[model samples]
Target: MTTYICDDPVDRRAGLDAATAAAARGELVVMPTDTVYGIGADAFNSAAVRALLAAKGRGPDMPVPVLVGSWNTIDGLVVSVPPVARKLIEAFWPGGLSLVVEHAPSLSWDLGDAKGTVMLRMPLHPVALDLLRAVGPMAVSSANRSGQPPALTSSDATAQLGDQVSVYLDGGTAPIGIASTVLDVTGPVPRVLRQGAVALDALREVAGEVIGAGQPDGA
Candidate 1:
């Protein structure tokens, strides 16, 4: 178990290298994101993903989300990007917005109980972006035990996760210190599954008429 202080350029580069190597080995890593710290694994590694779930004491019923380095990464993951999804991505990607879309049937990895859909996001943190760009898509979830408040700092993550995570990239406290707004885009209209950093009003501005999960379609 290693924790790298990433405020130093030298330490940051080294931490990224260690994290990339760890993911390649199918090991779990804790890294910073725009909203909070996340524990991540190589998205293609089922065993690693399972380990990530175990580390958090979470069940498959709550599937992990995937974090991408770029906007274009989502094209290959989902069956097809809806026009509204593109609009949302254009407006709030690299920030705090997660879209749940139907993943391509041909893909091999498993995130558990997601049914046929996957939640994807592109975080706006430099350390996270650099690591994701190097490691490809990662199965990431909030870095804390299930039902606990999300970790806003690497130390908070470490306190909960301990040696379960192979690499801990301490990128200081999370900038937003809140969870991302999660939206399900598989429906005819975008629906807000969980509201967080991004407001529903802002989502409406970009996609027009967004609905909460409780509301009926077209409401």
Candidate 2:
């Protein structure tokens, strides 16, 4: 396992290079993100993705999200961005927000049984962006066992992932010690699957009439 401690966020070239090499070789990497530390693998690399899932004890049915450097990268993976989805991207991108959309038929990479859908996000942290930009697209999930609490720092991630991941980029603790708010934009109406740092009202401001994943019988 190769580990690099980045003294300065801006001077993470070595760590970025190591991460890039590991991803190219279809190996998992533990890296810091704005919301939390994540276990990442090349989204296009089936072997790496599978290894990541196995390491995290994640189910095959549970699709992993892809991390990108910017919103422009979304078009390459997703077929089309809904208006509301676009609004949310503009409002909360570079922050904790993950949008599920229809995957492009042109994409050959399989993150899981996504069923023609893919979850994509642009992380707000510099270290996350740097890693994403260096590695292109990576299938990332919270760095921990599937049923365990998400890792908020590199130490937490290392403790859970250990040597399973090829590289660990230590960028300190995450600003938001929670997962990104996951929203499904595949259907006509945008719905919140899980609310985290971003609130429902805030999402509604950009995506009018946003609905929760489930509702009470009476209400």
Candidate 3:
């Protein structure tokens, strides 16, 4: 297991390189995102995804979210991006907003019992973006054990994940220090699944009339 300091350009490049290689090899890599540190694996590698869940003591029920490198990356992942979803992406992507959409049926990988849907996000962190661009989509979850606090620093991630992760890129503390707001866009109107960094009012401003999880449709 190795943890590389990413503040230095040389070290950052080395860390990203190692992370990319690790992901390609179906190994888990801990990296910092805009919200928090995440332990990531190749999204297309089922074994690696399973190992990531095992490492975190998480179950298949709470499937991992996929991180993308850029805005256009979402185009190929989902069956179709709703106009409302596009508005949300334009308003809050590369930040702390995640969207749940029906994925392409032909996708070969499994992210547990996703029910044909996938949660995707593009983090605003430079190191995370670089790694994602190199490695493609990754199945990622917060860097900590299930039911444990989220890891804010690379050291915190290492202490929790230990040897389970192959490479740890210490990209300092998370910029937002909170999770992203998750919106499910699979229905007629978008609904809020989890409220975090992005506020409901902010989302409403862009998408308009987004309902919460328990609220009836069109309420």
Candidate 4:
């Protein structure tokens, strides 16, 4: 396994190229995003997604969220993005705020226990955006073992994933140290599964019924 330092321009460009190629081959890459370091694989490759789960010591019951390059890509993956969801996307996307929407039934990709829904986000980091654009959609999760704190830097991610990953792109420390706020738009209520970067008030402005804090499950 090779670890590329993303400090220099030449090295950053080279690392992006190598990482993109590695992902296309269904191999894992540890790279930085706006919020945290992520371990990612080609979303369309079921075997690759399974490998990612193994690397994290995670079970098949937990679904990994996806990272996309644009809004059109978002529409392509989900069965439908309701107007309220679209409003949330417009307000906080390219930043945080992940939306759990109904997955398109015709698509053949398997992302663990997503069932009929998938969590999707478009990060604001340049390295993440570049990778997503080059490799299409990716099934990405916090680059750490299950139950561990999210990795803030690529080095932190590498320490956990180790040689299991093909390449580690060191893009320095992440901008946001928390996970994205996850909103479930698939259920009857638009609810916050996990809250971190985006607040519930912002979500409530667009969504008629935004359930979060004070709720039994999460916020």
Predicted structure with the largest lDDT when compared to the true one? 1
Candidate 2 per-residue lDDT over residues 87-109, each given as its tens digit: 99899998999999999999878
lDDT by residue (68-134, candidate 3, tens digit) is 9999999999888999999999989889999999999999998999999999999999999999999
lDDT (C-alpha, whole model) for all candidates: 0.95, 0.87, 0.94, 0.89
Clashing pairs in 4: none
lDDT of 3 at 98: 92
Screening candidate 2 with a backbone cut-off below 3 angstroms (N, C-alpha, C), the clashing residue pairs are 94-124
- Any idea what lDDT model 4 has? 0.89
Q: Which run of 10 residues does model 1 get worst, by summed lDDT? A: 209-218
Off by over 4 Å in 4: 213-219
List the candidates' TM-scores in order. 0.98, 0.95, 0.98, 0.95
lDDT of 3 at 153: 99
The C-alpha RMSD in Å for every predicted model, in order, reads 0.8, 1.8, 0.9, 1.9
Better of 1 and 2 by TM-score: 1
Question: Which of the two, 3 or 4, has more lDDT?
Answer: 3
Model 1, residue 138: distance off in Å is 0.3
Preferred candidate (TM-score higher): 2 or 3: 3
